[model samples]
Target: MVMVMVVMGETATPAHAEPAAAGSLEADGNDEVLTSKFTYYSGRTLADPSKTMIFSGNGNVPLAEDIAKYLGVSLGNMNVSSFADGECSIKVNENIRGKHVILVQSTCPPSVNDSLMELLLMISTMRRSSAKTITVVMPYCGYARSDMKRGRERSPIAARDIMTMIETMGADRLVCVDMHSGQMQGFLSPAVPSDNITAIKVGALYFAEKMVNVPDSASEDAPRRNVVVVAPDEKAVSRAKEFWNVLIEKGVPEARFAMVLRKPNLEEQERKEQPQSAAAVSATSVDTDPSTALEHEIVGDEEAIADCDAIIVQDIIDSGQSMSNAASALKAGGARNVYGFATHGLFSRDALERIDRAPLDHVVVSNTASHPIGYEDKPTDKITWISIAPLLAEVLRIISEKESLNPVFRLPKEQQ
Candidate 1:
């Protein structure tokens, strides 16, 4: 009895209940039970499965262990050590010849080099071992923002170069989470399927839970909070709408709706102008879908949030630059309480401190990008962590089953 692992797609089916997972695939006249064993640990990558073998890797052994546990698979072991000259050695103890492999690695700050090199080597090792397919799941996608950076001396196509490198490493597929800009996907040669999953659903659920006070719970000291879904800039308008959708689902009436719009991405901003010269390069379409590259512009109804409850800010990071600025404007505009939610908490360069000083009551983020241990130094008064693993797990199931992903996308809104 062999269990089948499936990667899910946008049209994947929903997992209604957690089946009593069988270690080995066994069928009792039920096709669902036939594949009873869990196959995916879940993050945000939406892919489909075709009864394939999925081997997980992320450079670090612990994270790989976590993924294995969630997938209900025997954890694959690895041996990695350094030499006196600071070089690294690697050994994967899995016989993965012709196996469909998934190497999970989030290139966070210090671990970027190690993770990249290890993942590359692991893929190469698997390739040499004759694995059938390789998919690299880089959760944070560190250099993603660099794809659209405005600089002259540096390469105008750094992000695309990274995409090229990943493909050259023998990856059959690539999946990254909410990129700084969706257009970053344009660099690839389309040899593989690259999916960008949104953390908005995760962010929505976080805000819905933390901000418990509604009109009924509003006291004199704590009047019904005004929940405004604010996007720091135009890029976040879609994410803000996601937050707004959650607010509506959480029993908030239609009147309590509003979103802060940001300036659109002008063609000039997307241009790569050579310093001291008039040469400018137009930004290429970053997504397989041509329509996605267009700038985001959300124009909510005028009565949106006319009698609001609270503001739910949705984003991937605060960085104190965008979220802080939006908080300032919301405070000045007389927002009752400014609460926020992001997927990845990359609080670099005193971002947490600046958020602490801002007019915010709470900020929710998921542990999908970085672990919660690092945020202990940040002010705890307004910070909260939501475990998105469950949601991610469900999404993984749907993708593997070839079912629709819309149901899971709607679940976070239901939590509201």
Candidate 2:
């Protein structure tokens, strides 16, 4: 069998050629080349890097590069542009005939529709180009919060709609990071297998290291620190519990889990009940503004949380209201310090500023979605970013090797 590896910008490297070192190729504009060869290939049972090709949409190029580097392959050449009318146009610069294609894109805020369109176009183009298989790596699946019907309105399940579009467009598999609801996987076609991975373990390991130096109770021989994992809402209780479990396994002692209940906002409900004139209703208010829609109330064992450090865990942090409210409530309940961890940080509106002013001492988020340009230069001392590229790269490798992905659901030994 002949090996074929498509390198960005440069010509395809032959199988016998020596692999280039990772990060040796600088990404130059849209025509950058990033190529590397797999040094060891035992047999067909392992992933044939030559047959695999990875591409990135306009949404998150940096993350795609990181994953490609990890797999010892270059990102496939692709160009995504927009027409005068704002329609997306995708051009695959490489020949992907009979090759397994992986596309990395996150349907996130600010331009969710555009990002999603780019993904669909890429998938359709790959299918038309005779690609052997297509796997969509969407780090942040947009409209995931619309997994279920709400109220009595005849609303569409947008998540399901997006899934149908993807399946119809010819994607063979789907992968997401910390999907807002696990049930969303059922929305996809049965033939299209989906994996909803979590970043809770990643967040847990980060906190474990920070809290490792805390003192243990005098009565116990082993060192232990009192810590409480707080869920921002009832829906996030499972996430908080998962984080707590990992913390325990990572040698964090005396960990407890709690949930913050959202109190109904009577004022917001009344406003919704009142008929609104089309002229009065702004486009932004089409969805309920989370910042003013609910109040938070902490509920858990008082002795467990009082005077203990608190870590609020959730899937997404949009607007930062829920996180701020939970942290404020925890402090009022006598919690000594408060921290927050969210898988996706969609800092919409004034979220970053709100988080900076909130009572949370520190916050950690996974780099599932790309931040705005120039955000890196900002002095956001309370926020830290952790990359999920390694986890995603391993998943891609496993899929290419045709291995069961059950092991990836749990925290790795090193992380624990």
Give one clash count per candidate, in the order shown.
32, 0
Worst 10 residues of 1 by lDDT: 25-34
What is the alpha-carbon lDDT of model 2 when measured against the actual structure? 0.76
lDDT of each: 0.53, 0.76
* Residues 1-416 of candidate 2: C-alpha lDDT, one tens digit per residue: 22222336322322232212221111222111211212111112225778988998877777787777767778898778877678788888889999999999999877899899989999999999999999999999999999888988789999999999999999999999998888989988789999998878867765676553245443547546578998888889899999999888877756888888878879868887788887656533323332432356778887877888889999998878788888877877788888898999888766787788788887778778887444566747677666676678878888888877776776544521
Q: In terms of TM-score, which candidate is strongest?
A: 2
Tens digit of lDDT per residue, candidate 1, span 153-241?
A: 45555667777878887877776667667787766766786767676655554344434323434354544444556665666677777
Q: Estimate each model's TM-score.
A: 0.68, 0.83
| Residue-level lDDT for 116 in candidate 1 | 68
